[model samples]
Target: MKTDRIMWGIVLLFIGGVLLLENFNIIEFYWGRVWRFWPIFLIIGGVNILFTKNKSQIAGIISIAILVITLGILFYKGQQPRQKEVTISSHTEESNDLDIPRDVTYSHPYTDSASVKTILNISGGGTSFDLKGSTDSLIIADVQRKLGNFSLETNKTDSITSVSFKMKGKSKWNMGEGGNDVDLKLNANPIWEVHMNMGAGEVDFDLSGFKVREFNFDGGAAALNIKFGDLLPITDVNIKTGVADVKINVPVASGCRIKTKTGLSSKDFTGFTKLEEGLYESPNYKTAVKKIFVNLDGGLSNFEVKRY
Candidate 1:
């Protein structure tokens, strides 16, 4: 009985840590998806109690192993990327309903300008989004949505260009007939500070061609695959994830340093030297002129960093 209680206590503490990270935007948990597996907890507890009553030590060990395997599968599934087909439709506002078009596609073309710094803010609720580098001199975007009022607002002041996207109103999370999606391609010439808040879904980000000064990403119940190609003199990258799998690829020549704080997550820093607990540095980190600093806080997620 004592052993069972201790095991349950440990389980509860693990769950509490995951929840705390979720609240801080370091992780996102969708109860609806995993609620069905709630019985697993009860089963584990029941098996543990049975072992205590019978004094079957092997049974207790088996129960714990089963629980671990189940949780591992759940984590693996959560990190898998999901694909959705979303088409771009013409924008038309008829009547006051803000009725969403079936193929509502908006393209913002790029025009050559003297802007040197780009500030981008991305906010979406339950939307699948894609981001990549653009060949044109101007930052371009093609946004498509099936429901809610989607807005792409931009501003420019001197050499700084600011762009923001939001799915306005409470209906942002409402997935109507076809679903919601945002596909963005931006010019990679200017220096950038990209801030992204993804409510849910999958994000595929490729920053290979852009000179990123600072990249901040916060996600909830999402899968992220990010590749960093080029970086600024002093690059700062901060990422927080919840109930997701995050994989980052760094350039071969760039010096990289990673610091992490995690809860119930597996971390793999391939080819990096572990200076100490929770600190990792690349081979050329000290000698390279350009450096990339990565700080990651994760909850109930899997994180991996690799050099390409």
Candidate 2:
């Protein structure tokens, strides 16, 4: 506890200094000035109590209160600025290189191949492919022939097609850190599949508003989170973890079934729907899983089936 308190003290002192510096011309990122001060309030008071003596009184308490109230207002006001809803239809063809289905609009696909997919001996820092605001396009990430960091993220206006990815991992000893962070938008509702493997590193994903056939997770030791974006529901999901935190979110009316060995039961997972044996419960259930399969592997945090 004492060690933790010292660490907190150091962190707060750093934040306060940064904020104080930013308040003047020392910094200029518009967000930096107003945003940096928040850490001071959050940490100082909490650390003061641990530091004892005159620590918890006067300026410390005042700073915490200011931080708390400022945060409350900032959040409340931030959410109030809702964008006007514009009608978006993907039914018509916007271009030849892309597919815009009746209920969706998409972007072009990627075509990269390798004879040895998994063992891509990367000698540089890392290669990156970022997908943004193509909410109706299906993305196929084939890591079955990939080596190196595979990082992917999508905002509220991105989507994928076919809903499947081909994934694979090298032999156990060859795996390393740094996988992918797939950010799902609150308004993303396209059906897609993901297949990727990680040697190491935390994989953070958001499933605020999404629909999919299933998820495939394999290998690695890390905590995973499957959380909702606000209050959202997703269906047709599957996951298997070696050793990590496993979470699942089930919405009312969406069909959910989890098939796993008893090993996944020990970790903390909320709202789990256990399936009975290898049973394919329905034509609906069978079709859902077949429609799209997203596979993920190895990350320190958040292995999720999302709703965005």
How many residue pairs clash (N, CA or C atoms closer than 3 angstroms) in each of the candidate models, in the order given? 6, 27
Can you tell me which runs of candidate 2 are displaced by over 4 Å? 1-190, 227-234, 264-308
Give one digit per residue, the lDDT tens place, for model 2 in 1-308: 34334445554454344334433546422221122133344464564554455444454555444545655554444224222223224323233422121223222333322111111111111111122222332342322112322223333312222322222232222221222222222124434333434322223344434443334444343333443222223434445444343445444234344343442123222343334542222224443423322223322223333222
Q: Which ten residues in a row have the lowest lDDT in candidate 1?
A: 170-179
* Residue range 10-67, candidate 1, lDDT tens digits: 6755555554565457856543244224456678777776777766667667766776
Candidate maximizing lDDT: 1
In candidate 1, which residue pairs clash? Answer: 26-241, 27-242, 28-242, 89-103, 89-104, 89-105
lDDT of 2 at 136: 34
Q: What are the root-mean-square deviations of the candidates from the true structure over C-alphas? A: 8.0, 15.8
Candidate 2 lDDT for residue 265: 29
